[model samples]
Target chain A: MFFHIILERNMQLHPRHFGARLREKLVSKLIKDVEGTCSGRHGFVVAIMGIEHVGKGLIRDGTGFVTFPVKYKCVVFRPFKGEILEAVVTMVNKMGFFAEAGPVQIFVSNHLIPDDMEFQSADTPNYTTSDGSVKIQKDTEVRLKIIGTRVDATEIFCIGTIKDDFLGVISDPSAAV
Target chain B: MSGEEEENAAELKLGEDFVKAKCLMNGEVSLILDRRLEQLQQLSEDPLNQMPQVFEKSLQYVKRFSRYNNPDAVRQVREILSRHQLAEFELVVLGNLCPETVEEAIAMVPSLKDKGRGLDDEAIEKMLTDLALIKSSSSSGHLLKKLGFGLASL
Candidate 1:
């Protein structure tokens, strides 16, 4: 009777041991699948999916995906040479003026300033129109050329030459009319 | 010494069997191998080997005009490097051997190839970003000329 009890106890331990081994195998497989799915290089293109605004999911492969939140922002422009661009003056200085064209920021140098205008102040240089027909003010709308570009860690600087025939202040007829 | 004595010494050193084997190797049956061996031997004797000379020439060319930092300058260098096979080889070697001189040359290769065809806006923007990384003033005119672009165009 004691020998029979010992055999029965061994049989019970066998199933428990088999179940634990199977569980461990399954867990390892799951961990491998997760890790393998996430391994990818920075430049590799990923398909984006999922519902709008909740969070965007990146489709890494057929088996797995990752998700991240998106931040909303204003429009940004990445202009190139010979591109016709419109910008509003953000700041004016003796050397040049800084303008925002969509998301891109550009500088128009003093040399590019129209020849007809004399700079009134060294600290805050104001220019008069070449024909004396218009007085250019701050926050003026202008068309520009992308002559040069410089990109830094935080910002991109585009240099425009006002010497071109097409580049200058835009006349607002609605304000006059 | 005497011609007959020299001939006898040569035969003794090489042996009759050795001469027979040499003749068999040089025979018409193996004419190609014999010719190749002769050519190699001649090259070994030549004072100025062509490959190393070509490498040295290329290095000198790169050292002379290594300014490719400016956008306009980069454009010029691209034109020059693309045109000349020797210039391209030099550019590659310069990048490998004297990295500092050839760094811009290495960066300019892709840009030159990219500009050969029309690129999308994003690609052009990326190219502009890539261009900002270089800082050299070497003339790439010779390379561009080799690529067949007109000097005026560059």
Candidate 2:
């Protein structure tokens, strides 16, 4: 889930970043520092939207680093329980399958799959139904629901299920017609 | 929606509007309920709405959900499941799946297996059958399902 939020941060500018295009320099620094970074509070900062406001520069003693309080809008991605997500199947194994929806890595345990679908080990491990109507393998796009989620400081781990109806393979790359 | 849920929806709206304007976005699935597609459709219809090329192309992704696109039917199905006091997970699964039989509903909701002491199969069958009637009416109205081998044939 992505949320558009205005978050505050204190940006420290080095002496070299002092004049013309200094604001641009500060923005570039902010993006380099903030984007792709994960926090316990805000999942992942996908991108910086726009600068809300930048406060007056506060000079630090001796260090000569100018600190500015910047408020900016950003898109934060956070996964939540019970949300249905469409993800690309990254791997398939005896235990289950691993899928990725953006930065979130989802584990769809075999126990959470529809009873008809079974894991078939081969050159490329896959899970297929008894009737052979549905097949799940690497590069397959699936619709799944998050049963559980844990957001770490660095990454998001999700427990997902495809047992529910309308929550399975959306497209099969291997079986493309 | 409750006050907190409304606030959450408002925040979600802000996120969507940002996605419409700035062209940066993406999801968790559960955070997105079954009902917001209509609102998104309305947003897409707005001449002022500026969606990125990716989002416009990906509108097909939302189209895949045409089966569960009926808000009224979904609400009714959710109500029936809640009246039965089914667990939240079971309710959501049933609402989205719209299972027509006790067996179908049971297949979608594993929670039914553990909570089966008092909840009989017949009761679930009836509720689901009723849901099916409601769902069939709505699904017939959905052009996407009718476009090819209908899910109804399954």
- TM-score: which candidate is best? 2
Interface RMSD of each: 37.3, 9.4
List runs of model 2 lying over 4 Å from the truth.
Answer: A172-177, B1-154
**TM per prediction:** 0.31, 0.56
Cα lDDT, model 1, residue A126:
57
**What TM-score does structure 2 among the candidates reach?**
0.56
Model 1 residue runs over 4 Å out of place are A1-76, A122-124, A172-177, B1-154
Report how large a share of the reference interface contacts model 2 reproduces.
0.03
Q: How high is the DockQ of candidate 2?
A: 0.06
Model 2 lDDT tens row, A1-177: 445578889999998978889989988788778876777555667556679999999999999998999999876665556556567789999999998766667999999988878889989999988888888999877878777766666766889998876578864322212
> For model 2, what is the error of residue B61's alpha carbon versus the real structure, in angstroms, after optimal superposition?
10
Chain B TM-score by candidate, in order shown: 0.22, 0.52
Score residue A127 of candidate 2 by CA lDDT. Answer: 93
Best by DockQ: 2
Model 1 root-mean-square deviation = 31.5
Task: Report the number of the highest-lDDT candidate.
Answer: 2
**Candidate 1 lDDT, B14-70, residue by residue in tens:** 222122211110011122222333554676874224222222222232233233423
Candidate 1 lDDT tens digits, A1-177: 000000000001112233436434333333222211111111000111111232333444553433323321111112333333446677776677887653356788888776776556645455566565554457676655556656554345678765554356654322121
